[model samples]
Target: MESAATDNTIWYVLVVLGLIYLIVLYRNKRATRRRKSRRFMEGKRMHDRDN
Candidate 1:
């Protein structure tokens, strides 16, 4: 019984950790996309300013 309980706890912890990792990964991808978009907009602004 104790072993089963321990196994359940480990599985739960692993699932939670996996979710947290996925969340972080998704946030990082979103942040990078935003940064790229900002950079593109800034470039456009500078191009317009030059013209």
Candidate 2:
């Protein structure tokens, strides 16, 4: 019975960790995309100035 409880606790911990990992990945991807878009906008501004 104790082993069963331990297994359940481990499963819960794994699920929580997986969710945290996914959230971190999503935030990182969003940050990278935002950075890329900002860079693109800066380039466009330079092009406009050149024109």
Candidate 3:
């Protein structure tokens, strides 16, 4: 019985950690995409000004 409880706790911790990891991964991806879009917009504006 005690082993079962411990196993459940371990699984809960692992799931929480996995969720946190996923959130961080998603945020990093979004940030990189935003950065790339911003850079692209700036480049486009510069090109427009040149023309």
lDDT of candidate 1? Answer: 1.00
Task: Please give the distance, in angstroms, between residue 44's alpha carbon in candidate 1 and its true position after superposition.
Answer: 0.5
Tell me, by TM-score, which candidate is best: 1
What candidate 2 gets wrong by more than 4 Å, as runs, is none
- Write one digit per residue (lDDT tens) for candidate 3, span 1-51: 999999999999999999999999999999999999999999999999999
Q: Provide the lDDT at 28 for model 1.
A: 100
- Off-target runs (Cα >4 Å) in candidate 3 are none
Mind giving the per-residue lDDT tens digits that candidate 1 earns over 1-51? 899999999999999999999999999999999999999999999999999
Q: Residue 47's C-alpha lDDT in candidate 1?
A: 100
Model 1 segments more than 4 A misplaced: none
The TM-score of predicted model 3 comes to 0.91
Q: What is the TM-score of each predicted model, taking all chains together?
A: 0.96, 0.94, 0.91
Q: For residue 35, give model 1's deviation from the true position in Å.
A: 0.5
In every candidate, how many clashes are there?
A: 0, 0, 0
